[model samples]
Target: MTASAEYLIALAGNPNCGKTTLFNAITGARQHVGNYPGITVEKKEGVHLFNGLKLRLVDLPGTYSLTAYSMEELVARDFLALERPQLVINIVDASNLERNLYLTIQILELGIPVVLALNMVDAAASRGIEIDAEELSRRLQIPVIPTVARSGTGKLELLEKTAEVAAENRSWKPLHISYGADIDPVLDQMETDIAGSDFLLDFYPARWIALKYLEADEQVINKGAEVNPELSSRLEALADHVAEHLQKTLETYPEAIIADHRYGFISAVLKAGVVHNSQRSDRLYLSDQLDQVLTNRFFGPLIMLVILYAVYKATFDYSALPVEWLNAGFTTLSAWMQTIIPPGLLQSLIVSGIIDGVGGVLSFIPLILFMFFAIAFLEDTGYLARVAYMLDRVFRTFGLHGSSVMAYIVSGGIAGGCAVPGVMATRTLRSPRERLATLLTAPFMNCGAKLPVFAMLIAAFFPARHAQMMFLLTIFSWIAALSMARIIRWTILRGPSTPFLLELPPYRMPTLKGLLIHTWERTWQYIRKAGTIILALSILFWALMTFPLLPDARKSQFEADRQQILSQLPEDTRTSLMQPGIAQDGLTREIAKASQRIRAIDRAESEATLQHSYAGRIGMALETLTQWSGFEWRTNVALLAGFAAKELIISTLGTAYSLGGADLDAGMSLSRRLASDPQWNRLRAFSLIVFIMLYAPCLATVTCIAKESGAVKWALFSLAFNTTAAYLISAAIYQGGLWMGIGG
Candidate 1:
């Protein structure tokens, strides 16, 4: 189809209303659709080809209302007003039609064509609630298609109706709802004045603009003032007058009255033979019944802990073999490259830098996949929402919103999420102080990038206690994040905690298709990073550690030492040792001793060469302070690379160890090398894990924080603050452990 034949249709809905699910069903896209809110913080677009037409579908953020109270609401409202899509597919939760239709009424006010996708009809039926789509369509004057977005039911019909609506090219006709005797006259005057002046009429309908002014929406008010200051001021004055009148007579403001009437309108629509509930009104639904035990104060926390531990245990148990297979595969690849590629800079770049470095991170792919699968399952089942609701009580104690729990969870509070999305998720929080606090602290969660580092350390040192160590680390992360949030609130971002109302979506069994899609999407992102960003950075770090060759004198001294060992051997033995693939069993004792000595000399020289390099010097400089935490020069180099990305800690360590003569066996993995190193004890491994978990976030996340928070200072503060906290905690643990003679 030609570009001109394409129709732009926007998908709109309240949070948890299956809007994105329907979008995915239509477009065959795998956009992250979560059971809870705040997953789609920005617009995602995909195309659908039907017959001779191309339908460009845009999935807007899920928002409860069109008012500018949160970033989501503003984004949805702005896109509809400015972009003016050909039609909007408004998905509503059929089970909770009244609450979902509040946003629908606001969308209708925009005077755009809308086809109501009555999503989750099966869920509604399961709950014994029935909705007559035809009657609802007739009353609202819009096509209402009964749908179960999860199963792709009625999606074709919904698209057909959408195309029909677009083909009509219908004129924009705003829906009008009565606001009662108290405020109707004021709205009439405001709407007429707005229409007469043509103020914001290019973007918004006249009556919608008036309603925004009445609602005291900051975005619309600011835009109005910018467009025409005099008209905006007059409207503001009129709005204030009516607001005062309403407050005096009804003891309520215009915004509240408007909301009440909107809900009232929705109620009236449902009451007009549109919805029938077969279940008794007094009976509790399945969700509420489950919430009774799942959300119980005592039992909820216990269940959450048990579930989290179980996920970790299952991940470790199931993924162990695959992880080993991947590790062995990478090891084989590195070994084969070492033999095939000549011993030179090119060989070093491929085998050590690219293979070993990126491979070390990639080796943990199985673990990451398993962990992400568990998290996605929990999220899809709606248990994560319940977890958030339970966490709200603790979050409030730390001067944070209940909404912040999801941000932390996304940041890897459960162990396999990213911090960039987590930081952006804070935009859902209304309180600026709480949002900033959330943005700053969310990075402390054990994000997927850091998972490899922790997994490696725990495997090497606490092998038998894989799940236990991970569980402890998860707890430690929460404690550290919450403690830091408390400190932030007590000082710079201090404020009273705002009340939070968390909506718990009904629990549904996660489909195999959905779980696999979510898992693969996240797992693929990790793999892509290893191949691209991690690959590039690994090569760069290798260069930094490789250049500036050893002086000629130093090289000769190592050569002379090797020659002396060889010179002592008999002539035939020397010739035999020099031959390729000389059998160790065939060698005499004298020749074997000489060969071992020469190999030791090579290893010593390799270590010295690394110590003389540029990266080694920088690592040496930090060693003075890092020594307290048992970190030597090599670990320091890896940690420094971690600032760019946490996953680099593993890759850089791989390169560093491989280049630093840890090539005892060509196939030895990084974790094994660390376990065999005399310097890395259990205490030191635990200390390093703690430090890595709490250190500065990756560079990408730092930049996101700066942009999201609208300040460079906060980003800088995160860097300085997180590193300092990490150092202090790690140092204390290492020093205290030695004093107590534990894990020595």
Candidate 2:
């Protein structure tokens, strides 16, 4: 359908109200993502085709209110007021209808026609809330469609109703609500003055503009003054007089009164038999009952630990077979390449460079998938909020605002989260210092990107107790992050401590579709990284490791040794070996042993040539400095590449070892290759794991830190501090372990 012919319908709602689930159900994968105009808040738009009609669906940011308090709210407001969608589906949490209705009321106030999609009606029902959608719709003068977005219940009807509303081409009309007699006079005056001057009225509804002035919304006030300073000044003076008059007489502000009246209206609506909340179990819902223990002060922390450890156990247990299968698959691929590519640089490149490098990435796909699945399950079940809730005390102890807990949790505090969103989540922290501290340390969590490296190491060296090791590593990360936050807070970013209050969402059973979709989204992201960035680095490292081929003299020397060993075999055995070699088995065995020695010599030469190559030279330089930390040139290369991304550590190690390290029986995974090598052992493997975990945050995360902090110095500090701390910790463990005879 033509763009102009398509109807524009916007979806807006409060956070966590299943608004996104509804959008996904309506649009499926036909969605395009971009940023809202002049804001970093994401904008999701898609097209839904029904009966050959195209509906351009825009998913606006999830916002609590249409106030100019945050970027998200501003984007939601501007898009509705300026872009002017024909109809908006205002999704609300059916369980918490009262609180969710607050946002709905504000949206309706913006003069936008809204269809209240009563999302999560099942959740509301489970909580013993029975909403009369028709009664509520009558009161609000809008259509209300009960829905369970996750299951697509009522989705078709919601869309059909939406199309009908859009087809009506209804003219915009503002919803006016009376604030008590205390404030009506001032609002009336402002509306009259605003209408008289036509101050920003063509863009904003005249009465809404008056209401914004009453609320003292900065954006609206600025816009008003920019349009007509004289009129805006008069409006501002009137608002100030009302605010002062209210504050002095009633001890409240205009915004507070407006909010109260909105809620008052909502309370009156619900009290009119529109909602029948079942009197079940002392009016306590299932979530509240469970939270009594899950968020308990004494047992909560202990339970959280057990739950996290179990998640790791599940991850390792389920992924073991798949990881091995991946290894065997890589090995088989390498063997197939050997048969086709012939024994030379091209063959080596295919076998060692591309296959092994990319294989190192593919090997961890199962583990990453499992990790993401577990995390998604936790988040979807609403336990992630409890995780943050239980950790609030720990955060306060570490001198961090409790709001930082969610940021850390989002950053993979339990494991498998991303730092970008985690960094953005810190915007909720009122204290700038606390937010900055969170921004700097959130990356310390074992994000999904780092899971492969940790899982690979755990499987290789601590196979017997991979789950235990993973649990310990997670604990180490938390200890390090909290401790670092404390240090930085007390030193550079010190400020007043603020209380962090969190809303604990009701626990719900995660649906299979939700888990699979989340798991695939994150898993696919890792796979794409492997195909693009990791593949490029693998080939690049392979070139750096392959070129500067052993000089002619050295290559000839190895060939001469092979020939000399062949010449030493008895003549009878040589002819007989070509005939019935069993009759001269002893001599034939001698030739085979000599040939094995020659191949060993060739491998040694390859190792030497790799050491002399460009990347090797850099690795050698780093190796010298990192020797105390038990890192050889090969590990140094992997660790260096890890600064860009943790997955690169695997690809770099694969390329490094494929070119130089002791040759494995062809096709063994990188983990197996490292395990069989002399340089790697349990102690050194543990050290390397710690080093990679604690080193500089990945480049993308570092960029986020810098941007969030609005200072490059913090990013620089994170790099220098993380590397220095990682170095010292790794050195201490390696040296202390060696002293205690722990090194193999």
Candidate 3:
């Protein structure tokens, strides 16, 4: 059904309520996650057909109150005021009745029909506490449905009540907290002033804004003045009068009175409706005991490390076989395509460019999927919150909030695989400075695209001894991130740390369905990006290496030189050169024949064209810049093209090093070739690895950073810093190696 024609149902609630779970259960696969019109905070919408009516459910971000202090509060208020959904499913936690009810009262003031879903009734009941749902329904003048959303209980009843409320088209009267005589006169005057103003229609009530103005809520005052200039001055006068009469500060008077009234109302309601048991139980005592240990000062970090290691080992070991199978399958398919298609540009495009480039990168999907699953499981089980608690002390020293530790850890493992969510996760930090600090350091983590480069380098340079080297490098990345985070925190994000006030959510068994869905969403993102950006870059790299082939004179001269050398060689030496040993004879002959054919083709091309073509000129330019680091022109070209996408490094190597063979691998592997080169050794290889590790993030990562941070400047800064770091480190390592006589 069209959006305009569908019945709109808004899901609104306080933070930590089961609103999200209820929304997910009701809508299932028909959900789209986005953001509010003008805010960075997330907005979720889902559509489902119930009783022949298409219900469009919009899940608003969680907020504590309708005070308009935070962006989320403003977005929630604006959506309710402007969009005016047909029904609001107000999900309130049964355990935290009073705090959740404050938002309910404010929402009721908006004159919208609300169906209360008293969620987490089971948790409350398990604690030997009970709420009379019927009494709550009567007192609030709304249909109250007690729900255990985690298990999908009372969902149908809740939906039925929501539809009933929507069909009735009823609005609840505003419930105002009565301020005593001291401030009542000022509130009345402000109300009159607001009612007489031309912009009165733009707001709910001038008295509410005036009350917030009296509380010195700068956000509300600014917004009110923007809507009606007269309102601000008049409200300011009213606030002054109230403050003077009450003998208190303007900010203190309103908040104190409002909170007292709210608590009083909640107390009265609880006295009438709730039954609390006195006895404590084994489960409660056990949970308390566990919390102490899990959130302990010492054990928490140790446990977190063990958990992280387990996740990595599981992802790496379990996915290795599947990844290998996928790579092998793609290789075989590419080889088959070469055999079917004659040796030409089309065959090169399909085998070397498309398959070896894109397909090679895509084969790592299983690993990505496994990692995402493990992350989702941790998130689902609520262990992530404890992780945040454990890292709070250390993170606070860096000027980052404790919550940012999770974002840093997640982003560090898989950088740009999906930075948007990593950035979004920063919302858990209360301090803006901490959030910005986390965002800046997040992309420094090695991402999935860099995985293939690391794998290739490790295989080539270290061989069977590579695992420990790989682990050391991974740890080094974290060390670098920690150091950078500390630097940025002190220099750029300097400020007082906010208090740690995170909620330790109860652990729940993770749902396999939800875990799988989240895993697939992230994995699908990687696949889509690889198909578009990575594939384009790979094809472009292939084109750069292929066109305007080698100079005819250069090729002929080299071939003639090689022929003369072979002709002059003794029969024994020639036999050794030509045939080699029995084991190596077949593969060596194939390579020799392929090299001869490439020479024949190069001899037919023009010198000027070969020199001026895109690849040659680009390589020449990079060679000038990279000479200090000892990179040959060809290696420079590959590294330059690799910035678009790291996987392209392998593809570029394949194309540049190809010897007119049916199989790309028939030529020396990029690793083997680099290792054998006189100019490169272990030291240069190590430096190159560090360069790749610290270089500018791929195109997708930069795009994600731009989108998430909402500034091109920050993305540019990340690129500049990372690229400079890579270059400086590589230069240092190379120059140091030369001084030590390790390499030329």
List, in order, the clash count of every candidate structure. 0, 1, 0
Residues 1-744, model 3: lDDT tens digits: 233446888999987687777888888888876656655567878998876667899989888877776667878887887787887999998877887888887787566788999998887776676888998888777889999887889999998887766766665445666676666677777767766874444556555655666677776677777876776777887787777756654445666676677677767766754546545655564345677887788887677666766666676678768877786787678667866887667977787678777775687788778878887788767787777777788777767777776776666443324444466567667677777777767666666666666666665667664445655666677666667778877787678888887777666666666677668766776788779887888888777767766567765776676566567545554554432122334545645554454444343332233345577678777877777676766667668877777767766665554423223243244555556556666776777777877778767567767776678987898888888877887888888888988853
Model 1's alpha-carbon lDDT is 0.89
TM-score of each: 0.94, 0.89, 0.81
Q: Candidate 1's error at 145, in angstroms?
A: 1.0
lDDT of 2 by residue, 1-744 (tens): 344567888999987788777787788768766666544567788899875568999988888999867667888889999989998999999988999999888888778889989989988887677999999989999999999988889988888888778878898888889998888998888888878877897778887888898899999999877889989899899989999999999999999999999999899989868998785757777788898888888988888899999998998899889988888988888778877776788987788888888888898888889989998888888898888777888898877888898888878787788777788788878788888888888888888777888887877788799889889989998998898889988898888788978777778776677677668767877788899988887887788777777788887887687567667887654443322112323445667675466557766877888887887888999887899999998888788788887888888887787777434346567777777877789999989888887889988788877877888998999999889988999999999999999977
Those runs of model 1 whose alpha carbons end farther than 4 Å from true positions after fitting are 1-4, 29-42, 571-586, 662-665
Instruction: Give the 10-residue window scoring lowest on summed lDDT in candidate 1.
Output: 30-39
lDDT of 1 by residue, 401-499 (tens): 999999999999999999999998998898999999999999999999999999998889899999999999999999999999999999999889898
Which scores higher on TM-score, 2 or 3? 2
Ranking by lDDT: 1, 2, 3
1 or 2: which has the higher TM-score? Answer: 1
lDDT of each: 0.89, 0.83, 0.70
